[model samples]
Target: MKQLPLVYHKKILVLGLAKSGTAAAEILHELGAFVTVNDSKPFEQNENAQYLLSKGMTVICGSHPENLLDEGFSLIVKNPGIPYKNPVIAEAIKRGIPVWTEVELAYRISDAPMIGITGSNGKTTTTTLIFEMLEVGRKQPLIAGNIGTAASAVASKATEENTIVTELSSFQLMGTVELKPKVAVLMNLYEAHLDYHTDFKEYTDAKFNVTKKQDASDWFIYNGEQKNVTDYASKSKARKVPFYVSGKMKEGISADDLYVYWNGEKLFERSIIALRGKHNLENVLAATAAALIFDCSIENIKEVLSTFHGVKHRTQFVREWKNRKFYNDSKATNALATKSALEGFSEQVILIAGGVDRGHSFDELIPHLQNVKALIHYGETTKRLQEFGEKQSIPSVVSVNTLKEAIEEAVKISKEGDIVLLSPACASWDQYESFEIRGDEFIEQVLDLNE
Candidate 1:
């Protein structure tokens, strides 16, 4: 196990006892730091804090004490979900105390080389595929960050012989200052998360932070087709590796109707891979560029791509019902993602969409809805989408009260050779806690039909 450097006996405050917070506290404690953990939940209710308390660390629960900042703490590690508007965090910043996400701390302590992936969409799918590709060569890569496992937890067990494949988000990257991955991938960029960020520029800059600390020796894999992505790549110090959809690039990966080419060399045929859509193909190209640069064999990469279905909740094909194919794309929490999901199917679709209103215009999705046989919308954005669907002359448009109702309506109207898709164009927070819960519910409902 590797101990974090420059942390011995330093007073550290870990705010919010989430998974990342718990891991950060443990790592700090292991490094001989005087760690104090604080959470909004009551002490008895906070299971993570209870375990940390049992480990002899100080625990404060139910409230965040503003005066904790004056206790001569050298640093504060904050959970990324906690907004900077939190009084304690703002106070800490005012005091000039360093505030970091657990990712930054993980980078500081990790002995392993890292491959960081970030973008608007395709992060989980690309990250998972890259980890599988690296594992093909017995590389023992640890997957972390937005993909589920906390990077701080992974870093504790990482060694120089291993590699960490991380799926970073704009939320995670915004707090990072010196996190330089050996291979950084910026998949396509889109206007997203304006609800959390100040505006589009802040969101774009946050995603680009994945490359901020890289040098000339590092590789930056990006979408050559996206001008926003290419614009960001030009400013990065890493060796630029571009991936394209229509034509070949001079220095990276590209795909045509048949094969995926890496630096103009044939890598894998498009037909063999299991994942669908041009978006997923872009994800494969990005991963291929990263894997090839890491010395992974083309055969190993091809093996994974051939059998890899896809990650859950992102255009995942569920069971067919009455010859109508069902897809769970609950992770399509933005307009661009839903647009991508719609492009995969050739037949007219019975689309289930609409969720929390992020104030984004669904105008981009209108063109993609041209082949829709029916539009079933639910949650906060239902009325807006239902109205838009009707205006766009989609054959059928219905507004439902819940996700289950939306699915039931779609199932009722879906015909043979039509696609039933759950590709919500907004966040799930208005109805469900997260996209995973929403997707699980859709799967459970669809599975019940089999009975």
Candidate 2:
């Protein structure tokens, strides 16, 4: 790992304590920084805070003391989930103290180059695909950032021969200043995450940060079909490589009904891809571009694409029971994601949807619900989604109190050759702690039906 001289002997505030925060705090302390770790969870209940305290770092828990900024800290390394609107962060900003998420620190310390992937959806699948392709091709790739592992932790051990395939989120990118990946992939853009960001523009601006620091020597692979993405690519200094799912693109990656092409040359047959959905096609193309840029062989890319089912919780196939197939798409946290999941199936779908109402309309989902035979709604948007189902003339529409009940109702209504899918069109925060937990529950419940 490279030396981070900027943080050496400096007073640094590590705000919030999750995977990213804990990693950053520990790294900062090891680098000889005077680190203070703060988290909103009470000290007794927060094991992470306790662990850091045991390392001789000062730890504060339960609340953000209004006067905490008076400690003369030179930098604040915050959790990506913690908004800048937090009073402590606002004060730090006002005081001209630099604030950053751990990704910036990861970039500074790593000996390896990074291939950063970010978009509204499909980040996990795309990041996993890149990692798998590189692995099969015998390229040393380390997966990190928003794909479960902490980028800083991965970077500390990364060598110059390794390639860090990082799944970046808008929240993580918003805190980055000079993080330039060797190959930056912008999958696509859509309206999302208005709760954390001020507006759609703010969200898009954050996503653009992935390629903002790249030079002409680096590569910027983006979705050419989305005008917003293309417009963003126009401003990037990197060599532009666009991927298309609709029309053909001569200079980059594009796919037709028969084959997947790379810069006008047929690289692989489309039949070899196991992943479903047009959105996934977009993801596959982007991953292919990144893999090719890294010198991964076309044969290796095809091998990975043919066997890789998908990332968990993002339209993953569960089990088949009584001639009925089940899919867990609890990662469909927005209308667009649900729409994409629906489009993947030609079979009649018994869609189980509804969760935390982010005040976004479900109107965009109506057109795609043509094949939905049954709709089971739950959580905050239960009534709204039920109404949506009825308006779309679905044969069966039921409102349930919970996901378990929704699954029960879907099984009863679903017939042979039908899909029982849990692609909630909203965030899981209103019911489950996270989409992963919600999806796990769905999988467990589905497996229980066997007994």
Candidate 3:
């Protein structure tokens, strides 16, 4: 890890002690910073805060204290989930104290070259693909950021020979200042997380932070088909490399029915790609561009792309049984995600959907329901989604109390040449703790059918 002289002996506040915050606080303290860790959880109940206290750092718990900033901190390393509207963050901003997330700290200490990936969607899939490709190429790659692992933890262990493939969120990007990657990817941006950012422009601006500090020597791989992404790429100082799904781009990665191309040169056959959906095609194009720029061989890229089914819970292909295919898309926690998943299939889809009721209408999904042969609705949104499916005149519409029952119904109705998909159009919180758990249930039960 690089020595960060800027943090040495400086008084820094590490706010909201989750995994990111704990890692940041420990790293800062190790770097000779006077680190004060804070969290809303009470001292007795907060294990992270307790652990930090054991390490000889000052720990604040239970509340923000209202006067916490009055102690005079040099900087605040905030948790990405914490909004700027928080009193402590707002005060720090007003005082010009420079608030940042742990990703900034990761950038400062890492010896490895980073490849940052960000977008409204596809970040995880793209990040995983790049990491796998680099691995196949024998390039040492470490995955981190929003894809489960903490960036600061990964960055600390990364060597000069390693490449850190990070999945960045707009929240994490918002706190970054000088965190420029060697190859930065900005996939298609859409309207999302307005509640956290407060507006569309701010959300867009936050996503652009991935390429904000890049120089001419760096590479910016973006979506050429997205006008917003292309317009933002124009502002980047990095060498722009855009990927197009429609196969119309003059340069960079574009594809036709036959092959995937890089700068109009054939790299691999399109049929080799195992992952479904045009959305995934965009991800593949962007990931390929980044991997190629990092010097990965075409052979290695093709090897990974051909075999990689998908990231789990996000349109992951489970298995084929009785000539029926199954996909676990439990991460489709909204209508848009389900729509994208539905579009990937040409075969009759026995779609199992419904989850936590956010009270939003599923009317937006009307146009995409044409291919759905059966709709097994479950969870809190069952009635709403059942109504939607019945209104759409889907051949078979069934409502169930649980996901297990829904899967059973799908199995009964599914026939040869059918695709049974679990693309719930709402969040999983109503029945499961997270989408991962919900997805795991689906995979286990679906696999049981083969037995």
Which one is best on TM-score? 3
| TM-score per model over all chains | 0.93, 0.94, 0.98
Clashing pairs in 2: none
Spell out the clash pairs found in candidate 3.
none
Worst 10 residues of 1 by lDDT: 1-10
The lDDT for every candidate, in the order shown, is 0.89, 0.93, 0.93
Please write out the lDDT profile of model 1 over residues 389-423, one tens digit for every residue.
Answer: 98899999999899899888987897788889999
Better of 1 and 2 by lDDT: 2
Q: Candidate 3's residue-wise lDDT over 324-417, tens digit each?
A: 9999999999888988898889999999998899997777778887888999999999888878888899989999999999999998998899
* Model 2 worst lDDT run, 10 consecutive residues: 242-251
Can you tell me which runs of candidate 1 are displaced by over 4 Å? 357-359, 380-382, 399-402, 429-431
- Lowest summed lDDT window (length 10), candidate 3: 241-250
